[model samples]
Target: MNVTLPPTRSLLVAGALGLAVLAAAAGGWYWYDAQQRRVAAAYAEVMTRVYAVQSPQAPADARARAQQELEQILARHPSATPVGEAAFELGNLRYAARQWAPARAAYEIALARAHSPTVRALARTSIGYAWEAERDWGKAIEAYQAVGREVGPKDFLFDEVQFALARVQELGGQPAAAITTYQRLLKDAPNSVRVEEAKQQLMRLGARAQK
Candidate 1:
């Protein structure tokens, strides 16, 4: 006697297969997410330890280890949330090493991709410093101005941007513009620690305040 599976049996088998597939997909996704979290946690811990090392000598090994861990995280998860932070940290390291162009590129990438306003502002400030170090006054001014506008005047980086803008103007042979920017900065940041320095700069430039 020949035996054949009933339609109900076939339907049940297909349903079970579908459920198994779904369960497998969900399990895989959960595992991948867990791995990502572990990588992120490791990166954070390393970064914290690297930052905690106060002595320059102490930071060398810590920085190297942190960088290695961050590199691994970046390799595995290029678009991860911590990737922007890692790029920013690498930019700082490059800047400290006087590798200006790489530092600037890293900072620009971090600034463009950073979701955190604070991180974006810091990346912008770092890019401006890199441009300033290269004596590219135009780029420096643009970077600082972008930071000031994007991060807003109330951001903690406001004073830094203002100072950078003023310095760029001065170095670009735009003394009058520098003076105007400095005066505005002084007015807006009357109690800023850099206010006295701004005044001295204005005096050196022979800029007379408009009464």
Candidate 2:
């Protein structure tokens, strides 16, 4: 015969199980919070190193050390919230070292991982800069155009990317495309700081501004 527990005893057992689950969930949350804090602290320390490496007076070994630290962070916390920023910083570091291909690779990683639109825009534009530095105008134009297609004109980076694209088009022997891009920039972002420069470019290209 099966024996049934008394009502009060059964209630106590259920309540104990419920409390255990709640305790486990709270413990898990606490651990997660602590881990996030630790990751943030680590990211901050790496940023300090990055700043030092970027300084004009930095030691020759500073960049190498910073790069190592950034790499370690990436290896340890690939899914951390700051991973994209770390990748972007790594790209900037490589760019400063004149490692154009590596810089572009890092920027592509940032583009893939960054949740913030600003960071994504920056990474995309920086990829273009890397190609531009290598005098690969076609690749530079392609990268810069990706920024426009993905981020659009309403983004704060629009005018800057437009200017870059127009400059590259001119460099690549596409004067008509350059002129049109300049005119579009003038029309779309009339109040941008780049407005004066765009106007001058239009004049140089023998194209009238959109007013």
Candidate 3:
């Protein structure tokens, strides 16, 4: 008679197979999570390094290298959390280079994808500046107004948006409106450094302060 394997042996073999499958799945998940973290960390580090180089004389090659690295990271991990921040940084670089159109596009993309309200506000401000660079006073006013409303009256950025909006109003042939906005900003932001500037602008607009 031929010997046969015990039923318990087959049960043990099945259990081992199930355990192996679970282990493989766990390992794959861990690897994927680790990869995502690595990508995010790399992106943050690159952005920090790029921002740290403050000299106007900083080599163009360095900036180009940083951009290339950021591009590669973004290409590899399109959905990374830092991608929006990277786009914002790139927009700043382009803006500093006076590349208004591309800077505006990049800032728009960053604003659309930004997860943080602070970052979105910054992108909005930058977009307003880009419009100003292009001398599109109407668009600049719109952008500044949007940013001002979003940032609220108590925020530090309030003064900046107010100033930008006033300038846009002046350029849009609404000097009276500009004077009114400046006067309001001066009253609201009495301690702000821009208060004096606002007063000067009001004077130039022939707007006398009410007694």
What does candidate 2's lDDT look like per residue over 1-211, in tens digits? Answer: 9998679989999999999999999999999999999998999999888987788788768897898799889889999998888999999988888999999998998999998878988999999999999999999999999888876557788888898999999899998999899898888777878889888887878843233
* Model 2 TM-score (2 dp): 0.83
**lDDT pick, better of 2 and 3:** 2
lDDT of 3 by residue, 145-175 (tens): 8997787667878998898899888888888
Structure candidate 2, residue pairs in collision: none
Q: What is the clash tally of candidate 3?
A: 0
Q: How do the predictions measure up, each by TM-score? A: 0.82, 0.83, 0.83
Q: Count the backbone clashes (under 3 Å) in each candidate.
A: 0, 0, 0
lDDT of 1 by residue, 1-211 (tens): 9898679989999999999999999999999999878877877876686466434676576666665665566676677777777778878767876889988887877887778878888998999899999999998888888877775445677777887888898889888888888898788878888889989988987744443
TM-score of 3: 0.83
Instruction: List RMSD in Å for every model shown.
Output: 4.6, 4.1, 5.0
Residue 39, model 2: lDDT of 94
Question: RMSD in angstroms, candidate 3?
Answer: 5.0
Residue 12, candidate 3: alpha-carbon lDDT? 97
